[model samples]
Each structure stands twice: as C-alpha cells, then as structure tokens.
Target: MTVGEVMSKDPVSIREDDYMTHARQVIRDNFLRVLPVVDEGNRVLGVLSDQDVLNIRSSKSNVTVRGYIRETPLITPDMDLLRAARELLDAKQHHAPVVSSSLDRSIVGILSDVDLLRHIQPTKRSPASVEEIMTAKVETAYPDDSISRIWDNMLHWDYTGIPVVSHKKEPMGIVTRIDIIKAGYARIGTANMHGRSSGGSMRVEKVMSTPLYSVAPESSISEAIGEILRNDIGRISVTDGGRLVGIADRHDLLRACLEGTGL
Candidate 1:
C-alpha cells in the first residue's frame, strides 16, 4: 500500500501565528498528539507535538508561538507505506506530513504510526514463532522501584514502557510513560496537601499496569503483531510459558518486512 492509501486527508493544522494555548486546545479537543503547521497558501512549513509543547512549558519561555514551530519529517504521497512507516519509526516520530510532489510541496495529508499498523495487519504472514523476531535483551523494572527512579530509567532508555519483574524473574506487571505521568499528578496533589513525597516512598506496584499483555515465544510473528496492534502498544514481551525471554517491537516487524521483500 502507498502512503496516500492510509494517510488522513486534509489533516488538522495550525498557522505559525497561532498562540501556544490555541495549539494546546486544538490537540486536546481533537485528541491528537501531533499537529502540522502550514503557511497561508496551505504549504507545509513545520509540525508540533505534545513533547515539544511540554518542553516549551517546562522552559517557561516568553517566546511566541513561532518559536515553538518545528520542522517536520516529510513524505511523498506516493511513497510505499512500509518504507514510510520505517522512516517514522527510525526517527521516533509519531507523525509525518504527506506532501505533494509538485513544486509547492503542498500539504496533502498526514501519516501516523497507527495508520501504518492498520495497513500491515491483514497482509501479515505468520512466522513459525515469536522467537524468530523477538529481541532477547529486554529492559525491565522491579515492583518496589520508586516512580522517580522509574521515570529516570525510562528517560535514560527512551522507553515507552518497561516490564515489572519479580525476584524470581517472573513478569508481574507493566509500567508505562502514561502511567508515570498520571502518578506524577497524584504525587504532586498528595505532596501539596499532605506534606509528603508520593514518589519518594511509593513503589511501582502501586502505579504499574497489571495483567500485562504477553506473547509466547512460540507464537507466530503474525500473531504477535496482531497482539501488539490490538493493544496499541510499541513493544511486547516474549515469554516461554510464563518466563520472560525476549521482546518484539515495531522496528522488528519493519526489518522483517524489508528483508522479506529484499528492500
């Protein structure tokens, strides 16, 4: 499939002149994590994401919205979906602006990781087992670990989530960036009202997502992809029965596809 097939046409966008507050409101109202910036002629200029907005807020900068504008990764409408998806994953970008090949580089649509996964789902061929694609070096966390420490680990590793494991090496649960953010709010609220540090003494068990989504090592690659897509997650832990073994991420699937197609 080509990018044009899966991209959202006429995506929502903002002008450089728009206020930061307006951009934040647009994201909230639309439930969007990224927004494109365009010129008056509807040509692609830049893009903005939740992370960029958060960084700006944290800096406490007095700069205008123009200063927050970001240069976005560009993809042609005719590009192969798989290739486009791989580029986005490699860049760690959630969205890319689809532009016309013509002189103007006119904004045509937007391609997101979610859209690429949807396209790959039905065409996926089952491999013999998850062991064929799973990466054995998996990052993990302990249940007793504090939220502050967990956040530091996540940031250091650039991980979206980490599996919580017991002393015996059995998976207990999973803790994600979203979970930590929620916990941060809870921590601040408690600390301000109760004069205590929520993160200083609290444990990962109190905030981690339980009933972790797991896949058996012997499962087919197609089946594993389906599971990851179903969960709307970036990675999945591979296990043998109940023992942690490896992991399968979006890049693994892309690499498999590229090798299979000799791309």
Candidate 2:
C-alpha cells in the first residue's frame, strides 16, 4: 500500500529553535521515540530520536537543539510503505518523515515501523506467541559484574542492550547502550575520565535499570507489539515464570512480517 494509507498525518513535530529538554519531554509525553524536525512553515528539516536527545543530554553539551539538526533521512509521500519500512530498518531508525515533493518537501506526515507492521500484517489472526519467535540464546550480565567487563561483553556481542541477572539466575534489570552512553557523558562532564575506568570497574548493579518490563512466552504478538508501542521501547525480554528465556526485538517482528508476506 502507499505510504499515505498508513502514515500518521499531522504528526507531533518540533521546531529547529526548540531546546533538547523540550524535545525530550515531547518524546516522553507522546510515547514517541522520534520526532520530525520542522520549520515554521511545517517544512521538513530533519528528524530526532530518543537516542539523539539522550546523547545530547549525556554529553552535557551547551548547544541548542538547532545545533543538532543535520540531514535526516526522508521519504516521499508516494513511496511504498514496504520500501519505506525497509529503509527505516536499514537505517535503524524508528520513525521517518513523509514529505510532499510538490510542496517543497513540506512535512505532511510521519511514518513509523509500527504503523507499517499494522498495515502489512493481519492483526485479527491468532497472535503469534513470543516463544515461537523469540531468540532463545539471550545474552545476559551479572549484577556484580564490573561495568568495564559488561561493556566489553556488549561490544564483543554487538548487543544494544543486555539483561542483568541475579546470582540465582533471575532477571533483575537491564543495561542498554544508551545507559552506557549516559554514563560516559556523565564521566566526561565530571572530568572523571581516569575515574571512569575505576568507575566502570565498579559493579553493574549500581547503574542498571531495575524493574524491567517483560513479556511471557505465551503472550501474543499483538500484546508484544502493544507493549513495545506503549513503552516506546525497541526490545523486550521474554520470560517464563520470572526466569529469562528469550528475547524479541523490532528486527525479529519485521522479519516475521517479511517471511509471512513472502516478501
């Protein structure tokens, strides 16, 4: 189907002149991970996501939001939703801005991967359970593990996030790339670069985000999608009675769509 058929019209956007703090709030309030950067005339300028805002905040940079504006990926209104989805996946972007070519690249709508999935998949069918698609070999971290070691593990595994587990092997929390980025920002801001190595030497239990959100193995794909959307998160850990089992991510869901549609 055409992008216009599924693109969210008149999406909540931010101006180039706005502040990073404002952008952060806008994203959180709207349950959005990305926002289109627009001009006074609603022309598309660029796009920003939670990671960008977090990076800015993490850096403790004094620059305004406009300073962060650069060339953002764009798609024409008439583009196919599947093509657009593929572009987003390739770019690892959560949202894409849809502009009208006849209107001087004027922002007309915003397309998100979730929207594309909804359009391409039949939601009414029996929802696929998480156990059926989740990656069973989950990478995990120990609570007492040093952050430095954990960071090494993350880089070695090329993981965006890793679950923190207790000595009993129970899921305790989660540590994400964003979290490490924030920690690095904090370290730089505090002039504690040397101290960071020592800091990173500390246990991950000190910084990992606890009370993680998760899904059960039997839960339907619909439920998983809803949780991902409602939480504005990129990944979800699957559990069976408080024990970590598998992991599901946006890529997994998209792959399922592609395979099911024979694309």
Q: By TM-score, who's the top model here?
A: 1
Q: Residue 17 of candidate 2: its Cα lDDT?
A: 86
lDDT tens digits, residue span 95-127, model 2:
888889745779888887778766665333333
**What's the distance in Å from true for residue 48, model 1?**
4.7
CA RMSD of all predictions: 4.2, 6.0
Candidate 1 — which pairs collide?
A: none
Runs in model 1 deviating more than 4 A are: 9-42, 47-59, 63-72, 89-92, 121-128, 182-202
Per-candidate TM-score against the hidden true structure: 0.75, 0.61
Whole-model lDDT, candidate 2? 0.71
How much is 91 displaced in model 1, in angstroms? 3.5
- Estimate, for each residue in 144-187, the C-alpha lDDT of model 1 and write its tens digit: 87766665566456566899999899998899766765555222
